[model samples]
Each structure stands twice: as C-alpha cells, then as structure tokens.
Target chain A: MQIIIDPYSWLLGLAGGLLIGLSAALLLIGSGRIAGISGIAGNLLFERGPDRGWRALFVLGLILAPLIVGWLRPELRAAAPTVNAGMIVVAGLLVGFGTRLGSGCTSGHGICGISRLSPRSLLATATFMAAGFVTVYLIRHLPGLA
Target chain B: MKNLIGLLAGLLFGAGLTIGGMVQPQKVLGFLDLAGVWDPSLAFVMGGGLLVAFPAFALARRRDRPLFDLAFQIPTRNDIDKRLIVGAVLFGVGWGIAGYCPGPAIAALSALHPATLLFCVAMVAGMWLQRRLMR
Candidate 1:
C-alpha cells in the first residue's frame, strides 16, 4: 500500500488544533463552561437556563466565524456538500439525537471531557472512533453501497 | 463580560475547525476512510489539540473559580451506560456517512453550504424528538 503524506496538512492541522485547544481553554478559564457545541445549542432549544444568553452568542459566533474568514480570504471558503439530501438528513438526525443521548459531541466528549481526564469521555471516544471506522469501511468498500 | 468571552471562544473554535480542514466534508471523510487513501492529518490535529489542552486543563484544575465566573461547571458523571455507547455508535455512523460532526456542521452553515440548512433543521428536529421521547 502507498502512504501519502501532505506537509501542508500537518502544519495546518497542528495550528488549527492549537486554536481549538485555546478556545476550549478560554471557555473553561473565563466562564468555567465546557466548549460543548451540542450541549450549548441543544439546551438553548430544549431547556431554558441562565446560561442561555451566552450559549446563543457562542452559537451565533460559530455561524458567523466562517463568513468572516471567507471575507478576508476567499480562497479559504469551505468545500461544497455533495452528498444527496436524503443521506444528509439521515446523518444529521443521527448526530443530533445520538449526541443528546450520549450527553456530548466531539467537542464536548472528545476534546473537553478527555482533557478533563474523565473516564466516561475516554470510553465514549473509543466507542465512537471504532464505530466511525466500521461505518466508513462499510460505506466505502461494500459493493453497491457507495 | 462572560458572554463576550463565550463569543470569543466560539469564534476561535470556528476558526480552528475551518483551518483544520474539518469544515470540509471531503477531508473528514478521507480521514475516516482507513481502507482507502487514508488521510491521517486529523490525528495530528487531535494530537496538537491535546498537547495544549492538557496544560490548559491543569491550569483549570488549580483554580477554584474561573477568571470571570463564579464556579467551574464540569460534568462529574463517571458511569458509562448503555445509552452512552449506543448514542456514540449512532453519532459515529452519522459522522462517517456525512463527514459532519456537530461542531463543524454548525460552523459550515456560516458558509451557506447547500445541504447545511436541511441538515441543521433535521438535526434540531432530532434533538427535539430525543428530548420528548428519551425523558
């Protein structure tokens, strides 16, 4: 098998990863809140709480941040979504519901929780990664699937 | 001040996702496709994040209260239940299929990506359904 390595990816990934860590750290150090997008967004809709205002603001920033970047660097615009509408819907529903039931998403459980040394986060991360690997394998390699 | 800080955190997180290639569905899918071309760039991203986060968490643990808040609000639950595993599996399946995790999906909506609106709507609906049925 051939292994492809892209230096640009490694550089950008590291830089971006640092930024993500910084952001999560900022949230923790500043307001003591976890940078869990699902918990923030879902709670805004499903449950009313005092933190709702800040959560909404954070979500708004998330929606606006990309536009701000694209304004400064048009070339950095995100890639288009090519998956069919049906497939996207199914995926979206699963993500929303699953994250809720599981109590976190990648940002929450994968990044923040693990960083906090939570055992539940460790298990959740391992399970999700395994499932993701299997799902990708089945979708990409199985005959007539892709 | 807290709201402002939260907004900044969100902005930084969104920028990180975009810069890390997570906002692009193809890149995410590429990372997941281990049997194919197999892009391991995302692993580097995770590693980089963890490197900084580990120290940041240490700082957090030493503090009784956050800089701008009254107290820390971390999750204390340690039990790993069936719901957790099942939900994680379902979330992973969705992620594998769409290459859009929760954060990046919401972040991509800023770009007006064609499918994002429907996906977000469905995602919100799913959340609503879970709240009603799961409780």
Candidate 2:
C-alpha cells in the first residue's frame, strides 16, 4: 500500500485531533457527557428536555466555528467540496439514519467510547470503520459504483 | 455556566475539525480510500484526540458527577448487539459515500452550501424516519 506522506497535514491532523480530544475532555469534565457530535446534534430534534439548551449551544458552536476562523484567518478559509449534491444528500440521510440507530458516530464511539474502553462503542467503531473501508473500495474499484 | 462550557467544547471541537481538515470531503475521502491515494492524516487526527482524552477519561472515572452538573451521562451498556453493528454498517456506507459525517456536515452548514443543506435536511428527515419506524 502506498502511503501518502505530507508532514504539514500530519502536523495539522495531530493538532486537530488533540483539540478534539481536549474538547471531549472538557465536556466530560464540565457536564459529564460524551462529545459525540451526532448524539448531541440529534437530540436537538428528537428529544426535548431542560438539557436541550446546552446541546443546542454546542451544535451552534460547531456550525459557527469555521466562520469565526475564516474571519480571523482568511488564509485558513474552508475549501468547498465538489461532489454531486444529490449523492451527498443521500449519503447524509443514510448517515443520519445509521447514527441514530447505532447510537453514536466518530466522536462518540471512535474517540470517547474507545478511549473509555466501552465494549459496545468498540464493536460499533470497528464495524463502521470496516464498513467505511469496504464501501470506499467498492465505490472506487467497482466499475459502476464510481 | 454549564451551557457555556458546552459551547466552549463545541467551539473547540469545531476548530479541531477545521484545523484537522475533517471538514473537507476530499480530505476525508482520501483517508477512507485506502485502495486509492490513501491519506493517513485523519488517523493522526483521531490519535491526537485519543491521546488527550485517555487521561481525561481516567480523571472522569474518579468523579461521580461533572463539575458543573448534578450527574454524569457516560454510557454504561457493554453489550455488542445487532443494532450497533447494523446501524454502524449503514452509517459507514453513508460516510464513505459522502465523506461528511454528522459533525463535519453540521460544521459545514455555516458555509451555506446548497447540497450540504439538502443533505442536512435529508439527514434530519432520516433521523425522523428512524424515530418513527425503527422503534
């Protein structure tokens, strides 16, 4: 397997990952909650409780952080994806359904759950990551899929 | 104060995703497409998150409740069940297809891209459908 090597991106990835970890850590310490983005965002729609405000605020911050960055660092402005919009919407729907059914996503299970050594999250993370790998293979290799 | 912490967490998480380049579909797709021009950057990003989180969770186990809250909301179930696997499979396929999971998608909503907006709408609809039909 050919490894794509780029030191700059590696540095960014590690820094970003640490930040993500720290954010989860903060949430855990402050509210005793996992920073699974899907669960936090989904709750805004399906569940109603006094706890909704924090979740909403968390989501709002997630949505707006990039804008704030763009305002501060014009050079770090986000680049737009060029994929077909219809396909993206379908993917989004599937992701939404799957995450709700699965009970978490990358953040919840991948980072927090795995770090805490939760068995369910571990299984879920393995399954999803494998599925992701397989899906990418099929999408890229299969004649009709790509 | 609790909500403020929540907001800070969100802000930091979003910034991490941005800086980590998780917000870009191409970057994510590169990471997933192992057979293609594979990108291992995301692995580093996830690793970075885990590195800091490990000790924090260690600290978490010592506390019965959060500092600003009355109780902890950590998951307690240990069972690896069908729902978890099947749901994850579906979610993975979707993530592979779009390169935008829930977090980045939400973050990208700030960009006001039309298709992503459609995806978010559809995602919410799918979530609603799951609530109505899956239970």
Candidate 3:
C-alpha cells in the first residue's frame, strides 16, 4: 500500500494528455470519427462484421499497453487500489448510462468536444465536471459510502 | 496511415495514463476530495495537460484545414436540454462513487487494477442499456 512519489508522474501526465489530444486530433483529422469511448465501445459491441477491427484494436491497445509497460518497468507497478466487485459493477453501469444519455463520455466531450469549441461539448464537459465534483463530495462526506 | 497514427496516439495515451499515476483510483479520489486531505497533484497533472493542449488547439484553429485534412468536426448543439443535465448528473454520480471516469478507467487497465475490468464490463452494459432504452 505504499505510493511511490516520483517526478516522472507529472511528465507522464503531460505526455498522456498530449497523446490523448493528439490522438483525438488525428482521429478527427485522418478518419472522420470522434474519439469518444462510448461511441467506440458501442460500435465495437453492436456493430457487425469486419469494419470493427480497428475499434477492437484501439480497445486492445488500451488494455495491452499497460501490461507491456509494467513488464518493462517494475517500479511503475504500484499496489492496486481497493474496491469491491459489486461497487465496480454499479459504477460501470452508471458510467455507461451517463455516456449514452449524454451522447459521449469525457473523451468525446471533455477532450474532443472542448478542443473543437463545440458549445454542446463545452456544456457537456461542464456537466461532466460538475457531476464529478458532486460525486466526490457525496462519497467523501456521506456517512454510509466511505 | 490514419489508423496507424490513431493507434500510436492511443498507445501514447495509455502509457501516459500509466506513468501519470492516473491509473490509480486512489490518486483520483484524492484529487476529488477537496475538503479533506486532498492531493493537489492532479491539479498539476490537469494544468500540465492544458498547458500542452491549449496551445496545440489554438494552433490547430488557425489552420484552414487540419494537418491531415478537413476542418475540425465541432458539435453544433448548444441547448441546456434535459438529456444534457440528467446525463451529467448521472456521470458525476458514477465518478463520485468510483473515482474512475471513462478515459482514466480504460487507461487504468495498464496498472492492472481489477476494478477496471469490472468497470469496463459495466460501462459496456451501460452503453447497451442506453441503446435499448433511448433508441
């Protein structure tokens, strides 16, 4: 349960953000798609046939890259955070629902949406941020959940 | 060529999440817990992201067409509609409860957090449900 304090964490964050923005920009630039997770995941799940290969690969890369990094750098590995299976499931379901209802997730609205200066995305991102703020308040302050 | 760029971008993003300590839910929780013993580190993380992104976006805007091609696909809607408000509230609730948003949640897998797997599963299910109900 020891958290390693490393200066590299900042560099990583910056680099990651750039990658996300760049990827999003590239996706918009190259392909005519928004790099939204809900849209991508939805297409992967429901859409039929060969066209899904890239989406699958995009997701697969998302899963596999971490393992590769962990293999290369042992120090990068840290104790996994604790949470129960039920909580994780519930949280996921909520996120799924929210993403759908909102028509995008953070990547779509927060990253892509904000970048494009879409008023809807700006509103959506603001809403997402506000929701995150409230959720943190309830979890930390409310008696039962903590 | 485009797909390759997208893939590389995703890999860099995934790596960034791992290196940034963003893959850890606790770190995110700490960032969100503003009133308590909060970790202000995420602010720096966000600030760092904005530092790069703000300028990059500004530069992108100046161009008539993006480097790859075409104008940026900006969404046109602006209404503070019910769907927008309700969806945001739900998203916030999930985030508050779990401390893992979609991007970070997917990225957290590199850290190999078991919770992320569950989160992903549920996230897919949520998408499914929305498709069923709304459509």
What lDDT tens digits, residue by residue, belong to model 1 across residues B1-135? 889987898898888888788888888888888888988888877877787787888998998999998999989999989999998998899888889888888988977767987788878887888899987
Ranking by TM-score: 1, 2, 3
Q: Considering only N, C-alpha and C atoms within 3 Å, which residue pairs clash in candidate 2?
A: A17-B49
Candidate 3 lDDT, tens digit per residue, B1-135? 545655765675566555556667787777677666666556555555455555566666676665564556545677768887688778777876787777667766655556677788888888888889988
Name the 10 consecutive residues with the lowest summed lDDT in model 2 chain B: B111-120
Model 3 chain B: which ten-residue window has the lowest total lDDT?
Answer: B45-54
lDDT of each: 0.85, 0.88, 0.68
Superposed by TM-score, candidate 3 places the C-alpha of residue A102 at a distance from the truth, in angstroms, of 0.9
**Model 3 Cα lDDT, one tens digit per residue, A1-146:** 22335556656666656666666655655554567767677777888965376677677666666667767876554334366788778888888898879878777777766766777778887887777776777766879966
The weakest ten consecutive residues by lDDT in model 1 chain A span A73-82
As for lDDT, the candidate ahead, 2 or 3, is 2
True-structure lDDT of candidate 3: 0.68
Candidate 2 TM-score to native:
0.96
What would the per-residue lDDT of candidate 1 be over residues A58-100, giving only the tens digit for each residue? 8888877878777776765666556899989999999999999
Interface RMSD of each: 1.2, 1.2, 3.7
Docking quality tier of candidate 2? high
**Candidate 2: Cα lDDT at A137:** 93
